[model samples]
Target: MQWIHNYQLFLFDFDGLLVNTEEIHYLAYKTMCANRGINFNWDFETYCRIAHYKSEGLSQKIYAEFPELYAVEPSWEVLYGEKKKAIIELVSNGAVQLMPGVSSLLSALQKANIPRSVVTHSPVELVSAIRSQHSILNTIPYWITREQYSHPKPNSECYLKAIQLLAKPEDKVIGFEDTPRGLTALLGTKAKAVLVCQIEYPEIPAFIERGVIYIKSLDDLANTQL
Candidate 1:
């Protein structure tokens, strides 16, 4: 049976959850660092954590790790902006691949006539690419990106905005996210959160206490009645 027996809408995150483009993003980040002579030798865990931010935010995060560089480098902003633009271009060219179960899961939702939308920190350019490449993009009409909100994920702005768009705030509105930051942003929106992990990450006991549900695969959700 599904987690929710009845829900008004469903919302999802694109990168890691819907598409396997996260690695491409990491590669772009590494390339950007190399071009700028920045030392970003982070392990997988560190990359996954900080990668919660998109290209622009990721650049800031990379800078924040090195205080001295961030302070003295007056040209950091312009340089980073250029790097982020390049990364976005790579993603726009259909380098990112969709995840395995996305097509089927989305098709089911569409057949059921349930309203769904995307809540992501990705910029509009990347979002457009995802939709254009995926034929099921039309299944989701309410797309809310970081630009629309003053605060992005881990802040509840995107989720709340989606709720307003769907015109529902009941517990029926379920959210699916792959990152902890996205899950944090989804908190207290009166929607159930289904975390679709790419790998087995540590469980946040605190978030579980707050009613977030963690799952290993999107296919597993198929068994859910909701």
Candidate 2:
């Protein structure tokens, strides 16, 4: 909690860090496979492991490792598109929920007037969808979404651009991410990077080896009056 105050500018990764959309995303991905008659019955635990795989060094990454998809669709983009569609539908049904302490953390940040922005690869439509249901999210003044950047996570381009726009030369910057892909990118900024997730992804231990700070949730921020 005290560490958060060390930074004057704060950046956050969306989807996992600020919200509990991982479960919704897992459901949406599973639904996409089911709709196409692909029996993608990986339980939540299995889906989480695969979903957290970094798409950084790879192109056209297929989230589902099923052969059934190649037969039904030529492009993996279409699968992701369908997955996005399902996610929006589920979100429309009030499926998305804010992660614990997100509201209090954002409120405290706003109260302190520390400059903050959400740097995410998520589309603006999905961000807006969540905001519609959780108005507390509106406390974030800037959202650097997919449309604003070309390169994604595991590349610092997105975060670099956000820092350039939001940080002053004298301000210490800190960023929060839920996975190694996003955390890798945040580390590139030379800002203090924090990993926040309770899920035990196999990929995470390698990061822990490198001394990445990990937290189960942002609930500690709720204790910060800012």
Candidate 3:
């Protein structure tokens, strides 16, 4: 809570940090692999490697490791189309839900008049779909999606752009991220970074070693004085 008062701007990652959509994405990938008969079973380690990239970059990262997939797998366009369709079906059927503590934390920030925004690798269409189904977007005045940036997370370009857009000093901002790469991107900027450890990943120690604060959920901040 003391940290919340230290920042003038707050930035957040979308998938696992704000919503439970990461599981939806994982399911989409799992379904795609099954349909293609690809022997794909992702543990946290493997997921972390490609999780921070945008759709195209993720495909490229996966293909580099499994070149055989390049031949057997559908083009990124086709594969992503299928993934999006799957997400749409799941969300439309009331299968997906927001992560716990998201509403309360956002409301707390709003009540304090802190400027907050989402910086995510998700494309605008996907973001729009989730927003249409939920009221999450109402708490955020601005967002930087993949479509707005030339480079995505782990590259630092998107975070840098966000700071520029906010016109705030980097030291006066804070970022909440759920992945290693997302943390790296935020650290590249002037903002203090926190790791929302909703999912256990093997690289968590490394992040902690780098001085990133980790929290179980946004609810942990409820007792913090704004």
Candidate 4:
């Protein structure tokens, strides 16, 4: 079996890994659709497929295909900004909870004096809002969000920025993610990534084929001595 090194830094993805907010994001998009007189619902499978695309570009592509729904919009950016704010409010309500084993794992990491950071495709404002609302204050020593880079996830830019911010080599870092796109971003970081399978994503054989180590929960970190 493969092994995780002791005393390594961690880079985490926020949406699915740190909190169960991916569906909240989809609900926020549905709320945005209310403004346009169209009811949009994104299933788990559909959201996963589209989330692999660049963040802002993903929203634009979805919006473009439904021009009839958003015909009255003055600008795409304005619409996107509004939708993102809606999402921030949804998350700020604390309706979404942290995933199982997250707090305990993070607590253990903190007690061990491991440096940790977040590497996410989420916009900086939304990421900060969620973090602050959830009171996840001191777990991260460094944070890298999409706003810090011109390129978004599924690209290596975010992860590269985390490594630079933490001043750690790839081999000395570890990453966690639940989605294929997030995994792609983590793998692009050149760090060993632990693939935490979500209930919505049960049969991800492709992830294993990509050399990702699959775990049922973040508690696996303790077993791996991370």
- List ranges where model 2 is wrong by over 4 Å: 1-4, 56-65, 203-211, 221-226
TM-score of 1: 0.82
Alpha carbon deviation, residue 215, candidate 3 (Å):
1.6
Estimated TM-score per prediction?
Answer: 0.82, 0.88, 0.82, 0.82
Which digits, one per residue and each the tens of the lDDT, describe model 3 over residues 1-226?
Answer: 4456677889999988888888888778777666777756776546755675453567777677666667886487787787788887777777667787888778777888788889998888778878887785667988899999887678889988888888555448888998877888898987877888666767788887877778878787765332
Tell me the tens digit of each residue's lDDT in model 4 across 1-226: 1232353777888887888777787777778778788767667657666765456666666676677665777476877777787887787777678888887777766667778888777777777777776665457777777778877667778887877777545348778888766778788766777888655454367767777778877766557543
Please write out the lDDT profile of model 2 over residues 73-130, one tens digit for every residue. 8776777788889998999999888898888788888888788999998889889989
Evaluation by TM-score, superior candidate among 2 and 4: 2
For each candidate, what is the lDDT? 0.74, 0.80, 0.78, 0.72
Q: Which window of ten consecutive residues has the lowest lDDT sum in model 3?
A: 48-57
Q: Considering summed lDDT, which 10 consecutive residues are worst modelled in model 2?
A: 56-65
TM-score between model 2 and native: 0.88
**TM-score of structure candidate 3:** 0.82
RMSD of each: 3.3, 2.9, 3.3, 3.4
Ranking by lDDT: 2, 3, 1, 4
Clashes per candidate (backbone, < 3 Å): 6, 0, 0, 0
